[model samples]
Every structure is written in C-alpha cells, then in structure tokens.
Target: MLIKPSTAIRQDYTGLAELCHSIDEPVVLTRNGEADLVVMSYEAYRRAEARVKLQARLIAADRQAGDPTALLDATSVFDRIRARIDDAEA
Candidate 1:
C-alpha cells in the first residue's frame, strides 16, 4: 500500500493520478497522521467493485446450497432463464 499525506495530492494532483494509473492500486491519503481517503484508478476501482459483487453472489450461492429446499434441477433453471430471454425478445 502507498501512503501519502493529503498535501501530496494538493501539491501534485497530476503526478498522484499518474502514480495511481501506474500502480493499479489504492493510495492511502493521511490527514493529520490518520488515514483519510483512498485514491485509485477508475479501472482498478471497477475491477474491485466487480470482485465485491462476485463475492456476494458466491456467498449467496453457498448459503442456498446448504438449503436443500432451495435447490432446482439444472434443466428447469435453464428452461426458466431461456423462457425469460424468449419473452424479452418477443
């Protein structure tokens, strides 16, 4: 993790932005010696967001798997999905 004082960004915004793009990781900004904000490139932020969404989905699936009553056969699941797609198309 890269840590920088809040003044660093104020003094060199372009340079800090370049650093974020080059490193593809978050830069922690400190204010008064305490953590203040996180700065990251847009692409990195998007990837992080997608990872969080995927993790949530996996957790939901795991919980559902532990409940036998929630289970549905693959064929029925696919058929329902296909029917939805067909309906949308129509």
Candidate 2:
C-alpha cells in the first residue's frame, strides 16, 4: 500500500514474510531512493497487478477521447437529486 524502505524491511524479515502472506495490498520496497520491488501475497499480487493494468487501459481510453472531469465533478448533480427527493417528500 505504502512505500517502505528496504533497510526497514530487512530489519524485519520474518515480519515481512508474515505481512506479505497476510496482506492483499502490495508493500513497495525502495532501493537507492526509488521503488525497486513490490511484495505481496502471490495470488493477491497477480490480481492487483492485473487490475492495475486494466485501470491503466481504462485511463488510456479516457485520455484519448473522454472528459476526465465528468467523473470528477458530479457533486452538483448529486445535490440536485437530493433536493428533488426532499421536495417530493414535502
């Protein structure tokens, strides 16, 4: 989920293994000031990576021909719907 420095990880090798087995989220390892490795439960990692790739594809699709703001700015629509529901009951 969050980036962890390698040194901190190496200090707790057993803990790391247990954490890897226990957690579905990836634990990133930093090396030389950059993210070098990611450790997670094997099956979980595969699934998460696949999802990430799919998300990337979706983002690419959005970038090529869609408005990113449409999904990002729906508060006004939500408020209007809420107001209509309140008025209907009144």
Candidate 3:
C-alpha cells in the first residue's frame, strides 16, 4: 500500500493500524512521490527479527566450527522435535 507522508501524519492511528493488519505486508509510506518508510505489523516484525537472528546464529556457528561434518542431519533434527512433541502429548 502506498501512503503519502502527509496523509499518514493526518490519518487516525487506529485506521492506519487496521490497514497494516489487513494488508499483512509492509505498507510503503511515501514522501514527495518517493518511497520513504515501510510500516509493518508488530507480529510480522517480530517474526522477521527472529528469522534474522536465527540466520545470524547459524552463520556464526558455521564460522566458528569450520567443519560442515559437525552439523546434524536436517531429518535427525526434525525427528528429535517430533519425538519431543510425541512425548509431550503422551
């Protein structure tokens, strides 16, 4: 969604918040016909931040370990998670 900065400044926050939630994506806030800021939901922002942190952690681990062989198989990780879920459900 394209929003003018002046409109954003003048519009009611509740309406803006509703628009952000309903869109489920970043709303482009424009200034002078140019893109300026992006408005996104708090939940979306949190999820994105979590993903970025996870990726950063993985990258750091890779740099420190210096060996791909030390990593567990993806399936093994999923299997462990499944086991934990099953145990919790039992």
- 1-90, model 3: which lDDT tens digit per residue? 546463674577777788788877778887788888888889878988999999999999978688777777889999999999999999
Candidate 3 lDDT score relative to the true structure: 0.81
Best by lDDT: 1
Give lDDT: candidate 3, residue 49: 93
Q: Give the best candidate by TM-score.
A: 1
Tens-digit lDDT track for model 2 on 17-70?
777777767899999999999878788868977999999999988786576565
- Give the winner by TM-score: 2 or 3: 3
Off by over 4 Å in 1: 78-90
lDDT of each: 0.98, 0.82, 0.81
For candidate 3, the TM-score is 0.59
Q: If scored against the real structure, what TM-score would every candidate get?
A: 0.81, 0.44, 0.59
Q: What tens-digit string does per-residue lDDT give for candidate 1 at 1-90? A: 999999999999999999999999999999999999999999999999999999999999999999999999999999999999999999
Collision count of model 2: 0
Q: In model 3, which regions exceed 4 Å deviation?
A: 1-6, 68-90
Model 1 has an lDDT value of 0.98
